[model samples]
Target: MTSVAEWYEKNLMLHRFWSVDDSQVHTEYSSLRSIVVSNFEETIKMPINEPAVGKRKSQIQEYVDYYSGAGV
Candidate 1:
């Protein structure tokens, strides 16, 4: 979990745009290197998001922009 968080902190583009303190979010499982934020006991889980960076805007960014904020 620590390693995953570290890698994300070092590589995520969201970090570039916002001061996203994503240390609380860690990957518990990944068949495709996707990001899955969940509780520590594994009782609750959020949707799995595949980090996609391209020349154009990504879906995740659009979602964030639409909502105006993110959630746990």
Candidate 2:
């Protein structure tokens, strides 16, 4: 298993973006997307999730509604 520290180093040394090919595109919605990062020592891991499209409202809009106190 690769240590977290090693993973961090590898990420920095080989920076790349994750993307999908146009031919593989689908109309299905993903409710959540996450990005995780850690400290240099790998002692802390911070994971962030943003909303994706859904049947009714997007996750991002829910966050906005909560933060804005719109109660939508």
Candidate 3:
């Protein structure tokens, strides 16, 4: 996620005071390596994910499990 962090840092001005859109953040069934990102204001949405291998689970799988379990 280093690239994401770097991009966020570089574009901090554009995302000023933005908040996560819990309802829209989810994984698509068609592709496990995909993530949907949205803001609380619903002004913007984006998909960010990459193929990665984990010890026992993929990164996207872990994220889906966490958010789903947390009821987000």
TM-score for every candidate vs. truth?
0.32, 0.43, 0.29
Instruction: Indicate which candidate wins on lDDT.
Output: 2
Candidate 3, residues 1-72: lDDT per residue as tens digits? 336634654674223233333233334432223344455564765555543443355555667577774122
RMSD of each: 12.1, 9.7, 11.0
Candidate 1 local lDDT, 1-72, one digit each (tens): 335444544664212111222233333421122354444455554444433344455555566578886543
Clashes of 2: 0
Clashing pairs in 3: none
Q: What residue runs in model 1 are displaced by over 4 Å at the alpha carbon?
A: 1-33, 37-53
Residues 1-72, model 2: lDDT tens digits:
124334644765422223233133323653555445566565665444455555555555577677984222
* Model 3 lDDT at residue 1: 36
Q: How does candidate 2 fare on TM-score?
A: 0.43
What is the alpha-carbon lDDT for the whole of candidate 3? Answer: 0.45
Which pairs of residues have clashing backbones in candidate 2?
Answer: none
RMSD of 3: 11.0
